[model samples]
Target: MPALVVFDLDDTLLDHRGAERAALADVHRMHAAHLGHHGVGHVQDTYHAHNVPLWRDFGAGRITAADLKRLRSERVLHALEAHDLDPETFSRDYLARYAEHWRWADGALDAYRAVATRFPVGVLTNGFSEQQRAKFARLPEVEALAAFAVISDEVGVRKPDPRLFEHVLGLARGVLDRPALAPADVLYVGDSFHSDVEGGVGAGWRVAWLRGDDARAPEGAAVVEDWRALLDLLEIA
Candidate 1:
């Protein structure tokens, strides 16, 4: 059976965290013009501090997408008391600017294309579809290498959930016009242990922990720090 390769989106394949940081800097500039230095950083700080928790809530199905966006804006506004800054309008404009500034990790495309020479590549990210599709637009090369692209919002399920893995795997198989490939034949590579690494293994695919600074994979999980090293781990080189 041909080995299928799956990848995570955020820090593993896409530089989302970096993109977010950069976007905040832009917000700082935009707000500083109107609100001054103290005012600008205030909004930036408040939003960054609150966004992760709100997103965690979002991931767990506790809130709607639109609600999360609006509330995030409202929280920042309330904290800074930035008058005339409407949460709804600010959120919409911020989303647009943020989406336009996506970046990809180094060696990501070369790594995928090298693997693509022999195996099918698919993306499985814990993100919304429209957001993800917009992200893909920023990295043209990465977009071309993948046979299937899956996101949590589009599938209505997040990583660590076996259903999302299975759905994406099915898409990869369909790309090859092959329906009988078991989950084990696919190789899943991701940055997060809790969601991507642990979850992929639970779904029966061989998991490869994409090394990041903040966390390590659970005991007994295989890991690859470099993108090219992935091919070597899979015995592709």
Candidate 2:
């Protein structure tokens, strides 16, 4: 059976952390009156320190998506000692700034093209369709390449969940016009260990854990340091 290659959006193919840092710098500039004492680096570090865990909590069902959105900026502001800043307003500003900067992970676009030339490609991401779609708008090439995209908000399920993986497989079958498509025929690639690696492996799919030179894959897991490594792993000519 031919394989269907599915990718995670943030941090996998998209340079989300880079965009976040750039956006935070913009926000830091705007709120320099309140954040003047702290460098933009400090603000960026503080943002991720709180932001990553909050999203993890959301994914783990410890917090509602609403709670994640409402509290993320609040926590950052509290940590920055900007008591005067309104969390809601700051969040809006941050999002507005974030929207301006979206780009592919290093070598990601080329890797995507390479893989797509030989195999069908799709996206299975954990995010709102609106936001994720907006990202596609910024990168038309990505949008053009994707045969289908399954957003968790649209599907009512998130990664590391068997149901969501099952949902994505069903979608892939329909899109590829291969009714007999099996889980083993899919390759799920993403950056997060708990979500992408665990979810893909759990779903009985071939998984490529994107470590990006950060760390080695655990024992037997397939690890790719970057898109170039991924190309080699897939044996894409």
Summed backbone clashes in each candidate are: 0, 0
Give the per-residue lDDT digits (tens) of candidate 1, residues 154-223: 7878878888888887787778787888888888888887787778878888888877432455543577
Model 1 weakest 10-residue run by lDDT: 212-221
TM-score of 2: 0.94
lDDT of each: 0.75, 0.87
Error of 1 at 188 (Å): 1.4
lDDT of 2: 0.87
Which stretch of 10 consecutive residues in model 2 shows the poorest summed lDDT?
212-221
The parts of candidate 2 lying over 4 Å away from their true place are: 212-220
Error of 2 at 87 (Å): 1.1
Cα lDDT tens digits for candidate 2, 72-97: 98899999999998999899999999
- Model 1 segments more than 4 A misplaced: 33-35, 39-46, 79-84, 213-216, 235-237
For each candidate, C-alpha RMSD in Å? 2.9, 1.8
The residue pairs found clashing in candidate 2 are none
